[model samples]
Target: MIGATGFIGLNVVDALQARGVSVRATWRKKSITVFAQKRNPEWCLAELDDTVALEEAMRGCDVVFFAGGHYPRYSLDRRASIERGRADVRAVCTAAMHADVPRVVYTSSIGTLDGSVAGPVNADDRTVDPPRESVYRATKWAMEEEVDFALARGLDVVTVLPGACLGPWDVRLGTTGVLVALLNGALPWWVDGIVNVADVRDVAAVHVAAAEVAPRGARYAFGGVTTTMRALFEDLARRWGVRFPPEELDVAAAYIRADVEEAAAAPRRGRVPMPRELVDLVAWGRRVDSSRAALELGVVARDRETTLEDARQWLERMGHVPRRAEATAVRSRNSAESTRGASAHAGSRKR
Candidate 1:
């Protein structure tokens, strides 16, 4: 596994490990120490920018799983974000082809596909044309082109387009992290939008199965339930017994566009607005299909209930919810209040 320490990558590593596979994971040079602490002891150091090191990491590997792609944060400068993504695709593909890895499972995203599909069962959907949502989508599609070139050269490769992956082992990054934050009461209100989502473990399972069973040139969609922003947050809140802001802010796209532009002008500490050209993203909605993935790769998604329950369990385990602690604090406060009232009454009688 190339990116064994990332949000999705960590889940992939854990799933693979549980199945008795010893992962020879790799991370960027600077990430080696932190990744090493959490990953298998056999983890290797490879800089994505260093072609030679990347090639060495792929050596002797039967299948190379490229989960190393980074999604640009909303804060990145536009041009630099595009360049970084292009560089990643160039570097990783160049190294993999050179190392002659028999098969490479490249993790792309549902963003690369047209979001106009009617629902999650639209198995006939194809790729979208130019002028997309985010720089991340553009770069991911660009990487897909590299994989196409590799396929033309008779290299065995399969690509997976995963929807928003959410589950445990999240280091609190990615889109899933945003959901986590909302569940933890950080987000003020539900941003009105719809997204297809799947558990990280389910996505990882598809990747591993694709690596083992999928044929060359197969592209699979790894999406689970289709949901609106409102529905997802509501479900999560109910599961966790937490209260979320149900009040949807009535901001139109024009309002957001103007504000985002103003914000972009000032460029805060590490935050960047979505590209002004792509501000229509929140208004865009579509379902994805993973039937192909199911039929071909035998990937079965845990039902929506299971996924939500698992997410709640994960939050509890991570101490994101101090349920018992909150209860104890409330009891302590009540006790103190009772004692104060009794003492005040006794003093009044003495007076």
Candidate 2:
């Protein structure tokens, strides 16, 4: 398991162990892998640049999980980000070929896909050009292109595209940061756009299945529940006893703001409520067609409310946010529903 220290990587690790499979997880030099080390008994120090070390680590392994790739903190440097992203995937794919691993499951983003989202989109949606406006999209497109080259050279590899992921063990916050910021009263307002997400557990399940039996050069897109950010934030506010932020920022304005916010947050890696990637995703994100994964990989879509509730409880358990009363939240949500109904009735009577 490569990228065992990351959010998706950790959950994939848990899934691998659950299947009674022995795992040899890799870690970068700077990461504190103690927590991962505790759960994953075997660990190897392998950096992305160290092809020799990666080959040695993959030696005698049945499958390799490539979840560790270049994730840009800001969408500022297009050239650097694209080059680095391609290089990382190239290194991993080349190493897998050298080590003669049977298959590699690479974690990619659903953001790289493009098509008419009037209904749903699949692998047929990929475009010849990256959305030039967002560097995040470009970098992922470049990475996937590298995987295509590797496949042509006879390296066994499958790709899994995951949208926004929310769950526990996201110590670095990742996509879950947007949720944490809202619940902790950091994000005062939000932009109205589509958000496609799934529990990290479900996404990891797809990874395991893909590695075990997926056809070489196959790609599975995993997206569970879709919602508008406004609706999600309203539900969270009502449940958590916080006032709803009614202001919906304009999408174009939001893009500029996030760029500035990321520039400022770069020094501290501080948790800013909005990031460029989040803006880019929601603005351009489309509903995914997961029929292929569902039919072939046993992917199941969980409801949005259930997924969010689990994520919130986990965040509280980890002390990332203060624990709130479930019963109280339920009661408050019920009361709000009653109030809205009554107001609607009153308006009808007046009309």
Q: Residue 114 lDDT in model 2?
A: 89
User: What's the lDDT for candidate 2?
Assistant: 0.85
Give the per-residue lDDT digits (tens) of candidate 2, residues 1-351. Answer: 888988898898898889898889888888768668768448888999999999999999999999999988787789999999999999999999999999989999888998445678775579888778889989999999999999999998899998889986786788888778877667855688887887899899999999877898999988778777877788888766666765678889888888888788888867677788888888885788788889998878777777788888888888877677754676678799999999999999999
Best by lDDT: 2
Give model 2 RMSD, 1 decimal.
6.4
Q: What is the C-alpha RMSD of each candidate to the true structure, in Å?
A: 5.0, 6.4
List model 1 lDDT by residue over 1-351, tens digit each: 777777677777777878888778887755534643565547677888888988898888888888887565542355666667668767877888899988988888776666655645343366645335455666666677777787897778888888777777665345545545555566544446666778888999888999999988888987787777678767766665556764565436433653454366545523222232222333444577788888988887788887766765666676765454674576679789999999999999999
Displacement of the residue 199 alpha carbon in candidate 2, Å: 1.1
* Candidate 1 local Cα displacement, residue 174, angstroms: 1.8
Q: Candidate 2 regions off by >4 Å?
A: 115-118, 325-351
Q: Could you estimate the TM-score for every candidate? A: 0.81, 0.90
Per-residue lDDT, model 2, residue 11, is 91
